[model samples]
Target: MRSQDENGRANHEAGMAGGEEMEMVEVSSEMRRRHQRPRKEEAEETEEAMSVEQVFEGKRVPGWREQLTFRAFAVSFVLAVMFSIIVMKLNLTTGIIPSLNVSAGLLGYFFVKMWTSVLDKAGLLKQPFTRQENTVIQTCVVAAYGIAFSGGFGSYLFGMSETIARQTTELNDAQNVKNPKLGWMIGFLFVVSFLGLFALVPLRKIMIIDYKLIYPSGTATAHLINGFHTPQGAKLAKKQVKTLGKFFVFSFLWGFFQWFYTAGDNCGFVSFPTLGLKAYENRFYFDFSPTYVGVGMICPYIVNISVLLGGILSWGVMWPLINNQKGKWYPADLPSGSLHGLQGYRVFISIAMILGDGLYNFLKVLLRTISSFVSVVQKRGATSTLPVLDDGSPITTSPAVSFDEERRTELFLKDQIPKQVALGGYVVIAAISIITLPHIFSQLKWYYILVAYIIAPVLAFCNAYGSGLTDWSLASTYGKLAIFTIGAWAGADHGGVLVGLAACGVMMSIVSTASDLMQDFKTGYMTLASPRSMFVSQVIGTSMGCVIAPCVFWLFYKAFKDIGISGSEYPAPYAIVYRNMAILGVDGVSSLPKNCLTLCYIFFAAAILINLLRDLAPKKIAKFIPLPMAMAIPFYIGSYFAIDMCLGSLILFVWELINKAKADAFGPAVASGLICGDGIWTLPQSVLALAKVKPPICMKFLSRNMNDKVDTFITSLS
Candidate 1:
């Protein structure tokens, strides 16, 4: 039977190639009867054809039994587990560097790659694996794991430390006694870490279906799998694998040069300089640390912008005012035994900037969500219900289906009948959020928790909107906004660290590996890998990583504390909050700038109105503007991403232009080569680090200098 056009929607059973515009069809009872049986028959016929081809193609492997061999399962499990552990270690140790996260994602992609390749070899599926499949799976798994683990572990560790420090310090000051209850704090943190799982559910639909973000790491993995499946891929893989081995050796040598020679104190090599102009420095300065820049590159550009913006607003605007008012804007010389004035200024500025941004963003999100909800309800009341089939069946026989059918149905049903039933689901989610809110906010004081409850929904809405636009997750934005608000309320010194850590976790979970995951998913969809399997693999991998992350963080925190360097244990932002609380007291909460809060409220109100309007509009118009989300994100973050968008557009334009001039294969091959080259570049560094070799050229210069200083310092100091 010929497939019906059904408007423009592609027939899943048809197995059509290339990009074609397809229309979505509503499968009424008749349409289902017409198409379902034929599709199943076609699928069976295709399977038979595939089996015949396999018999002629090569040696026949047994069907299900052969595909699920012990060897394959063992390899997949080991790779997944080991990769998860390695990724957790690197992420916890290195902060949220994109490359590290991407590498971790690549490991996850490998499993998917292997799974697909094995299936192809067995001829269980007709379509062979592609690089894109690995990319999507790896990206999703890495992103999901990164966000959850980072947010959970980071929050638990930092929150525990700050809460204990605050309570004990308070006790010590008031009663002239010291308290040691690190164990209690640790126990409390473990309990709170479980809350991280709650975030996963709300985010699942958004990440998987609505946005359809692609994970690049999964694509890489699929490439590997494809290599094993096809003769062409196999030959190329062999050559490339050998080259990668050599590259690893080269990278290791280069990595060591900087690590050994130019990285220590007094070599003038490894200082972390705060960017922009410092009031005390009287000029802009640069820090000569390679680690920070390398790290900065890996960090999401949006985050960097947010951080930098916060610093600028605080130091460039707020601090100068405060200092000038206090008659200490500038001193002729450094104060006796005092902290670096510039650093101190920047720290304060950063704190205020966080306060402003968090406040503004959170309020906007809350208002937008509420507005969207109300608007949805209003639309339900006004719009005509979907007409049932003539046979009195609820299913419609339309060739075209609407987007968000479930939501529309729910709203329609809610509006058609009683007022009380309509309010039930809304109440349930709210009640659940509210009950969970206290547990989530348990570390904070009751009043502070109250404040956070008031603020969190706003941030959540903003995050949802932000996610809608760029196909980026907004977990970090919400978490950061939450932390900042909490810190501002609780006092900067005591609450800052807890909030910072929590924010770090949130950022790590949501933002760190988002792009890679989206790319992977897109590949999987194209390749026709089982979505259920991909989802299962992601959950399993992420859960394993999350389980062990806290322990690793604790160990790092202890080591850093001993060395008197902040390291992972002491985030500078949190420290600033603690100090402020000690000096200023709770009255400081009153001192929070009203301008920031007002701005937040304005954004929130505007978002709500936009969401309402969008929801009330016709579906066609609604498609053009995700107004609910647009209201939630800050202008600054949007602007930062605009830069990325422009760059991407330029690249695409150049590629299209080139493709027009050259063979179609040339442009695609060049693009593929660029991607492969980028991925390959990391292998050399990994190998070199493993081998403990000095790198060549400029890297060697840095390494040699580092070694000389270490030797000299050891002799003189001893």
Candidate 2:
């Protein structure tokens, strides 16, 4: 207490000393951030960081705050609608799904802060948005996003409906009918998605609480929210807000110039020559989107290096070999979308690595989960006779609260979601899943539903484990395995196979949705936001998504005349992958082209080998190893996109070399703004596209036509 007082006094004296200078120089957020320093974290804390004992014993923060509020809900709902629609549209056109949590945090904090200022002027506003409220808003954003993309919403938008139509003989024959079981699909999604929510609660305790696993993205998001919620945090956030605002505006404008002014030809990347070789043919390029660069900056340098390595390995080395050995190892005529270039080959390798890494990570978590169970069981065996009527208080209460600061600091951990309410919601979800899973897919027998019910908990366990431990839920692969199993038993041989495959998508959605929920719950736990509020927000988003997804899909479907065509706006890589999974479920991988299968095996092995190599490599080398996802992602997307992504990463990769400390501290702020700016700008352009208004067209036309002379001169010189 004395130290805190001394520190505050010192800061106040410092402020007074600078008061005259403050008049001459504007006191910006950066100035405040540079000046303010907490005497001691706890003494200066608004919401104290969790104690080490709390981490080990699974104790909560010691205080309560009302989290569910009108402001939080209202913000969540609006962003949910906007992000879902824009996300679906972007997913279709670009095949890249941007996370809206950071964007949500940014926009929510700004708006609420602005609104509070307005209200304050009117003498009505009492306070700024609380950390809990901001968390609630983020909860909504994540929920809405997961629902739109993971909950069969985005899948349906891209090509699931038509894929179902093509695969189902009965649906195909129906006049002007697509996805004949659309209603069933809607119900199936609702049930599976929500049921997984309730069903995963048990696992949440094991994974998030007891084991205390950190969902990587979720943990980072929690910290971001934390920064905005508290006074000390807010000061830090001020510095970021400045950078974020400037860069966000800059990025949005730059995106507009590239996407509209250049007719999408110059979107985010610049083609660069590698050794001046046409054989490379602009295969190499640098993308300058701040978001990508930010992404590069945020991760450890080695991860960035690994990404570059993957690009070089696949495009530079692997492509040449594949080209030379085309007729022997690869097919004579590779499918346009499948291994179209070095870029095409990247997809297979990435998928292999992602699945391989996910499964490997899952196993690691599984051991922990199992060990936890063993410990619990062993504890029961060692129980004493004196504790027959043991009190629960000892276990629930923290014993270390001796001082005033300790008590005050521990205040935020006291409240939690009510057990009865959460469990009841889960029960409702379970009942819905049992009834709807079979009803949605009519071909499935009672036993199949029973099997799915039996398997759901297990799948949820693995999914939750992977998500909690590694932040990579390999639910898609696991879902595929389950789908293949269930589809076979449900009789994939029958004409009702498409229905069965679709059920798998729903099943996967359940695992995914549940996995996502647990991850978010972990975030809530860290931020001292009520898990109940997060759950409620999630349910709301999921329910809203059920209606919103199809509507958004229908909107884009109408707006874009040629959605899935070669030059169409929406590439929908996921939808394409999902379609292939359905086909593989029905026809089996054996029926696919021999060369494609061969490549799958080779890549799968490569993926596994690379991961093992990275892990086994000495720490110095291992730290630089790129994640499988980094290597794998480039292969599936356009070379231009990959190049841009790499470019963003390269900036950080280089920035770190220049100044590691400054790069580490301010890099995230810049990177996040850049990412959000580019992503958020897409909505306006998309709306214009939907309205059929060609923005910047006249400017582009005049410039291109007027520049023909310059172009001719340049061409003649070349």
Candidate 3:
């Protein structure tokens, strides 16, 4: 008789390609039980989770004692500005960023706590800072951090405004669509992001209450704030909020000194020693970016290792191969600004890998969403009231709806945003998109705007679903897919529309902000924060981000002076990818070298296969499949970041090794400070440059002809 696997495959609609191998791997119950993975057992363990109140409820002060306060409002604004500036600078330069909520919370908690202590000593203070104030303040900081980077909003665009302007000018001379001005991009994104606020109310029930998503990152933040502010933990050392503040301040100042005193166009140091093998010079060296260390500190070992492996494959192995056949695979004299010709081909492959990984995960989440919703409907045997599009058509409605009287209370409308307001906001944003998009990036096909608006809500929902469940925003992935999907609609006439690409930015902001909001709400729920207050605070943070992000971008421009030029101090890599992807949307992949295109397809397929196999594999085995973003980012940039990140992570790793118990208690505070320390100093350096003040040390870009288009555009606008 055939084995069970053989019998199963034989009875299926399509026979398994390797039934014998499948059957061979199938083990008997005794063998399987003995060899079952630790991870599998862990997953199967039906352990109780910590309740929200336990995780977030203040052990010292207890819970829900305070509403929003003036102090919370003021502290939130200050922290938002600080996070926005640092995040903008890091995203523009190193192209790697870490979240700052915990760090900001520690700092906020410290300031108020320290001051309160002084007041108590002086006998003038009525009350000290509370857990409620500190939590709300940090929540705002995290929201601002979310919106200031590549996947969040147009901050990435403004960060690369010079490059966009230059790309537009180059295209203008070539008779392509002239890209919109930096201000236009900012204004559009600001409005789009603000309108996303309306999403917060409706999404609460689905994302927060009913689904009860894990939101791992937010949960961690909740714990961090709670740990520091927990009135009295059983342990003595666990209660020091002041110590975390010291770490944040010390790191922030250290970063300022470390980078500000450097020479060259970039503060980072890259060593490219040829060692007599001239062809391999660029492949061997360290490119140190401090934030990489901070980021790695927070990331898992799997991600760190994956990034390192990817970098080795792309820069160390494949780069040499491509270089060896330069005349055929690429120009013997590669494009000057393209990281020693490695980027000329490696970028395409990296993007393909990144896109493949992102889309696959998205598809999984999408299925999860469908399944969850279906399960809910089936269990309830009920109908749901859906909203309408601005055009008066119902977005989703089932006639076989109408629940029992008791079930009617389960409607999503309870304690959510007013339906009419959400509908109105959608209509206004849609009108704004359709009317303004064409005028900004004139070359886009007309319907592309409509496509953006139509899909924005859907994208927001799905992206939020992923974020709520796993705290992975997937906005960058969805943005790339959007560019392709909308641009594909251009068809044979033109490969892609510039408008479609711009819309990609807008939709990215829309969805990312919505996801970020959901995370913020999770924190709010745990802390017993007012939903309406968070909305107001988040909107304020978004507004400040729009106002302050440009200044920081300009500051970086002043310090670097030649960012857009090839081989400049700041490569602004994310911008380069954005520029290229937008072009690809308009022009097909045919413009790339045949070898590069082949490599992209191959990597894309491999990424897809790996992701699919992970889904099929046991939980233990699947967990090791280095996350796609983790692997692909290093390939896209270089190994320098991965190496540095690992170094940062080693700090945590070693801490855990020596003292596992306290590592979780104080590790986040240290990590947060490490991330923010080197970043916040760039702002002051920016101010010094604006005053025509010569710095104690000045580093500038070393490109052959770095364009100052950003300065020129700023002047023109002024």
Candidate 4:
């Protein structure tokens, strides 16, 4: 059943890959099907579709109230906590988080299915598990943990810390560095996160129905949910649960085992130096991180390869060449992690590439969104028989609607959120944020907050439209744009760094939540779940996340003594990068090391050129092109995890060669286990650290001379 579900997801992706042409073909086919007599298979399909329609029409599907169950919320809260830990760990460590939608849905199904079965066995079952309920669980859990990602625990927010400030080259304003406080963090999130939901609420019908956007992730998740409620899927899910459970335990034990060796700095599988000392100096060894390995499994092959290529280019080639110039290029005696030396090149060059790529994609998506909106408007104008509402929703139009689409439209429109309420809610939240945010981060003036809110809707629509077309959310890009604009606007003497970072959080929350809400609407449409249920679930989840994400980050911040420190267990690499971006915005290019700006310019142009080449190149050649964004990550951090990810990719490649079906069926389950196990281990690991309990062994590797000297000293002492 998982295999079938995976195939459905694959098919949806492939169909979407055809882009606008596929959409046109699908529309034409629907129109043709309406006119033609159905063949046997087509008739069977029609029958199945009719049954689904009947379910949504109220014979089987639950109402909005029934969908939002106490049991679902209970399950969501538990899973949200667990997934929050996982997301926080990923955020702090690699700053790259794979989507956990499928895993959340799977786990939701597993837990609920187990409950229902036990109840049925005891004859105490009052209600059976429904796909709608499972969707609520998935939605709530995703939204809750999503805050962990968007909360900037590892980026803009954490970057405000004094620890991260010390790592930069610029003189950071003492007033700008804000430490993580549980009280203020929760309050900050409450002020910022919910506005985005209301920002896009009025456009739900326009985006999902009139635009007919794909929203691939939401559609795939819906398919996965629908698949799981079937009898065959239940049995399959049981096997998958066992598999996930078994590996999760193994990964947990592995983490525990690895912990013993990490009694001292650089003494463990994490820094195993797999390629010996010379390569290790260049950061080209696998650190044996299960989280990254699992991430690689879930991410596309190209992304993993791109990261490795980036690592190789930076640590392998560029850094070595730059280091040769020593005192001429940068001061020779600076700390390895100091931004005044080689670290400057690493951070700035990567930032250059990131900004370049982000700018190109932002323009691309913005233009595409504009063009598509124009096209949609033209089509709507050409066919205007039915009366429309102020929101552009048709009153009774049904032309060109397919059987399935018509069915979904009926259910989706059944509980439409009022436009007045949406607009009023947005205004209230924005007003509150504009008023309250200045108190939270005094550097960010009320006007900055107001401007971010004012322009947020336009950017939110672009992001939502782009995400619907291509499953990629550019929320972070929008945030960075805010950072630069507001930071420069505020200037250095006014604590622009903190202002920019704070504004980033506000802008990011709004746009990210907007796109996310639209995606959930897509899921709700496909699964016949009520928009009201999804919206309520999102609010509850966001509320949970406002409290939970900050608390989790606080635990890590308190427990791990060296968090956000370069070369430490949790480098939080993006913190320094984001902080530097704010610095650049305030101080301009003068803060860079000698010749760094020239290198940055070269890389920036190179990034844009590479993107153009990828788009213009033939598919056979284009697939090999490395992603600038993926590659930029390792420039500051290192290649060790890149090796780990490639190893995962290699494992997947071999498994597919051995048995494609099993790989497709159980691959995500296995990957999720590796990630969750190691991720969950962070909880106990933090607890132990907070208690000042150290591991028993220090498995350090030394140079031959150092080893000989240690041995001689030990012998003489004896």
Number of the top candidate by lDDT?
4
Instruction: Give a tens-digit lDDT track for model 2, residues 458-505.
Output: 777765654453344545555556555665554445433444455556
Report residue 463 deviation for candidate 3 (angstroms): 2.3
- Superposed by TM-score, candidate 2 places the C-alpha of residue 34 at a distance from the truth, in angstroms, of 22
Q: Scored by Cα lDDT, where does model 2 land? A: 0.52
lDDT per residue (tens digit) for residues 1-718 in model 3: 0011110001010111011111111111111121233645634531222333444323343223243566666776677777777766655554544434546766677666666779899999865576556666776665555455533222235322445435322222222343324476466656666655665456676666555565544555555555565545313323435455566577666656555455534343343222222322443344554555766665456556776777777777877677788666656675544422455576577667766765676676566656655555564434242211112232233334222212222322323456677678777866776777666655555587676767778777876665554344556655666667775566425524454456666666666677666766766555555565556667766776665655555566666566544345555655656556655665667667647777888888888898687667776686576555456665644566677767876887899899976776666556666666656666766676667665366543333333466567679998
Better of 2 and 3 by TM-score: 3
Candidate 3 lDDT:
0.54
Model 1: how far residue 336 lies from native, Å: 10
Instruction: Return the TM-score for each candidate structure.
Output: 0.47, 0.73, 0.77, 0.91
Candidate 4 versus truth, CA RMSD in Å, comes to 6.7
Lowest-sum lDDT 10-residue window in model 2? 1-10
Query: What is candidate 3's TM-score against the reference?
Result: 0.77
Candidate 4 on 1-718: residue-level lDDT in tens?
0000000011111111111111000011111122232357645754565555444454477899999998899999999899889978876777666656777888999888888889999999988888889989888988888788778888889999899998886857586688888888999999999998999899898888766676756766776787787667777887887888888998999999999999988898988878998899888888888888887776567667878999999999999999999999888999987877898999999899888877776676566666656656766755422222212343333466567777788989999799998999999988988889889888789988888888999988887786675554667777888899998899888898999999888888888788888878988898889999999999999898888899999999999989999989898888888899999988889878899999999999988898788877876687678777778878888898888878887888899899977887787788889989999999999999999999999998888998999999999999
TM-score of model number 4 = 0.91
Identify the candidate with maximal TM-score: 4
Residue 526's lDDT in candidate 2: 64
Query: Model 3: runs farther than 4 Å from truth?
Result: 1-66, 115-130, 150-182, 233-261, 265-280, 287-289, 338-342, 381-416, 436-439, 443-447, 488-497, 564-566, 691-718
lDDT of 4 at 453: 89
